[model samples]
Target: MALLPAAVPALRAENLSKRFSTTLAVDDLSLTVPTGEVFGFLGPNGAGKSTTIRLLLGLLRPTHGAAWIFDDPVADVARAHRHLAYVPADVALWPAFTGQECLDLLAGVGPGTDLAYRDELVARFGLEPGRRARTYSTGNRQKVALVAAFATRAPLLVLDEPTSGLDPLMEREFRRCIAEAAERGQTVFLSSHKLVEVEAVCSRVGILRTGRLVEVAGLEELRRLRRTEVTVDLSRPAPRLRGLADLPGVTDLRWASGLQFTLSLVGPPGPVLRALGETDVARIDVREPSLEEIFLDYYGEVSA
Candidate 1:
């Protein structure tokens, strides 16, 4: 039997670092996204997410380490770029060109493009194709970039805060496009602070914090490792919750209106269950925290 060769990853970074003046913008970051996977790079603002993106795009050279778009090194800007399409956080278009013209130009420059799908995207995004770029609003400009990127035949799409000025309805449409891209076997590297958006599309996520890669895991695995929020309502007031206060893996304990107790729990619930038996509980609600809550655990009061 003959062995099959391994497929090249869509994106790869090893010990990637970037520094601006005295500030270390991106610090020793490493990550990989397999071909055709929708991967999310999650972080708060100024967590060096954009810096990392720039480095990957070869717009900024890393102070150390390297990155690749498939087998092409990012240092070879033109070669690496041929393998991916990029939509930045902020988009700037040729003011004199109409929206349709802009889309045409983008399609022409890319490795290839699905022109029929591009037309459909223009309609789906509600872009006024005849309008000059200068007349387009911020959201419209973003739409132009999105339509171009999504319509391109490039294997990988690098999106940085891709939904900047989009309204909720358009945001939903953008997510739909992402699903279509994945269905077509396109790899997407999505960088954003929006937990809900990432949770909706990304199969795997890497959390960046202060220029460093802090965690990378599947959503389910991340949830399992984090604390769950639990609320308990008692039939009547208990004299004390002495055991719960000192209970292992219990934190943020508080008493609410009408004998309600709320707290976060981690690890085994056996201890928590045993303690609750001491009180006359009316109702109990336990839920896995939202992705945003999990994000907050990693960045508390850090302006996420």
Candidate 2:
């Protein structure tokens, strides 16, 4: 129902830039996450992901750019933030207090927190409300932080590597919870390196490399841009030198044995498959490249 009055973008960053004394942390990046979705923010280490988040939260000023939330300029972030909840990568809570105490403290910071929902999270996250923060494990502490954040029914949730210390079951819980939130028209900006999570939760993604955005689109669209792997099997040793590498969309070839070989395939498999048709093949296999490989095109080993 994007046509609805509330269907406009919940978060937008246009030409957002930030700088240090000798480095540009964020450089002319622009992206928009519409209502009722989870948008993934991905980038490598030292890619200015954190810096950008700080800018959006008004924790830092932009060098030359603008940010908006719910159609309001970031200069009024304090007002816009009432509709947003931020879950930082690090768990920020007092070490000598019970779980309930920390959530109560967070509740005091904003509106929408209720005792009923707060109690629900204590159980949902498997946290012992009576236990102090110092007695909790890293993952448990993370759970407390999330419980505090999600307990607020904020329309926009800005998460930075939120599941860093969660267990598999908790991560699954988080995915289900986020999906439920989206069903209710809540917007999520999930920042992380977890490809699988993004693939499962986000409706679209924006890739940041060296403080700049290079791509923004649906998950399937990004996957289409990545290379595919084609494995061919033969009964015995490989044939003499062939024109395999020169074929259209063929790259990074590897010969496992006389009977097996693998190569990267881009575009439709027709051309390469047709060319290899001349060889005697027992079995054929094809699969999409890993998300890491696809992302590598943006955040490669070297900085952009």
Candidate 3:
């Protein structure tokens, strides 16, 4: 009896870098997305997210390192591409072709596609497949690309700003498709700055800043790193919040009207809760930071 070979990762990059003129677009970026996982690439606009995607797809070669798809080097475009399907931020289609014709052409050029699923996606996405590509709106054009990409039989799906031109309803549909793809054991590489989009689907995320990979971790872990805002209102007498100022994970302690206290908590809340128990508390509110707030904390300021 023969032994079987081990399965390869869906995507891998080892110290990948890209330079243009004087600007370094991507610098020493390394990442590994395991097979059958939905991974998110998160960053603001102009953070080299698009450039990095181009490098991975072999549309732009890296200046210093390499990337691979399912063990196939991206430098070998034909072979690497056969294992992945891509939907770019701005999809370009042949103007002369009808929507159906464009889908047909894409299906023929890719590794393969499920015809029955393709037709079903056409209906589910509410795409007018009979219309000429030139007449479609940006959202409609996006639908065509999405329908085609989701129906492909490729092992990996690379989508950049996938919900850009979609309405809220369609965005829900897109999430459903991603869920189904993961269920079918396909890997998805989703690139977007939309915190909602990433938080909804990705189990893990990579935060990119100024051409560098800053951090990569599970969403829950990332949330833990962010400070939680807590407000407390006292009754007649105020207990000493001075001691709370010395508590671990407590910062920005502020008091207002001799009765209200506010502070930022970074770690466990048990200590603060116990401390508050000694105070004459009237009302208390604890607000978890939004995903966008956590994402922004990583950058410190908005990018240009």
lDDT of 1 at 281: 90
lDDT of 2 by residue, 14-99 (tens): 88888888788888888778877789987655667788898887778899888888777877868878778788888767988888
Q: What TM-score does each of the candidates earn? A: 0.80, 0.80, 0.79
- Candidate 1 matches the true fold with a TM-score of 0.80
Colliding residue pairs in candidate 3: none
lDDT of 1 by residue, 52-160 (tens): 9999889998999999888789999999898889999999999999999999998889888888999999999999999999999999999999999998888899999
TM-score head-to-head 2 vs 3, winner: 2
How should the candidates be ordered by lDDT, best one leading?
3, 1, 2
Of the two candidates 1 and 3, the one with more favorable TM-score, higher being better, is 1
Candidate RMSDs in Å, in order, are 5.4, 4.7, 4.8
Model 2 misplaced regions, further than 4 Å: 1-8, 225-251, 256-260, 265-293, 297-304
